[model samples]
Target: MILNGITVGIILILIGLYGMIAKKHVFKIIFGLIIISTGLVLFFVSVGYVDTGAAPIVSGDTTYVDPLPHTLMLTTIVVEVCTTTLALVLALKIYEKYKTLDISTLEDL
Candidate 1:
């Protein structure tokens, strides 16, 4: 089960990377980044899981998933959101300046 999750997460991350390279559109790139982020979250979350456990907390009785990776994943997610937002903003700004979102025509700048 854990291996399966890892495999799926790697596939998702690879697909996202392919999408990033395959698309020339900036918005698509941002979406690709989001996908990548999701894949990373999945990967990290899976890494933190134990066979049988309860989430780590101040007061807890059962074994738990590794909280460190989960916490890191959470922070990574926030950073990913910010990255996508900034990507969108930059794309929009580029479009406004060039009147087109195509990267091919950006050479004149």
Candidate 2:
């Protein structure tokens, strides 16, 4: 399951990279960035997840899932949200000024 999640995350990241590079619309590029961030979060979480592990706070002889990845993911999510909001706001302003979201069109103006 963990490997599957990692594979999915990698696929998402690749798709996002392609979108960002090949798509001409600002919205699409932003969406791609969002996808990449999501993939990274997913990958990070999966890396630290243990199949037969208990919660980090649990006490016993059993394996425990590492808490660092979860903590890091929490921070990553917050930063991603803030950055995405900023990117969207900038994109909105760009659209308002140029009346179009196409990169080529914006470049012409």
Predicted structure with the largest lDDT when compared to the true one: 2
Tens-digit per-residue lDDT, 5-51, candidate 1? 67778888998999898877777777788888888888888888788
- Candidate-wise lDDT, in order: 0.82, 0.91
> Candidate 1 — worst ten consecutive residues by lDDT sum?
100-109
Candidate 1 Cα outliers beyond 4 Å, as residue runs: 1-3, 58-60, 107-109
Model 2 C-alpha lDDT per residue in residues 40-82, reported as the tens digit of each score: 9888887888998888897768999888998999999999899
Task: Estimate TM-scores for all models.
Answer: 0.86, 0.90
Q: Best TM-score goes to which candidate?
A: 2
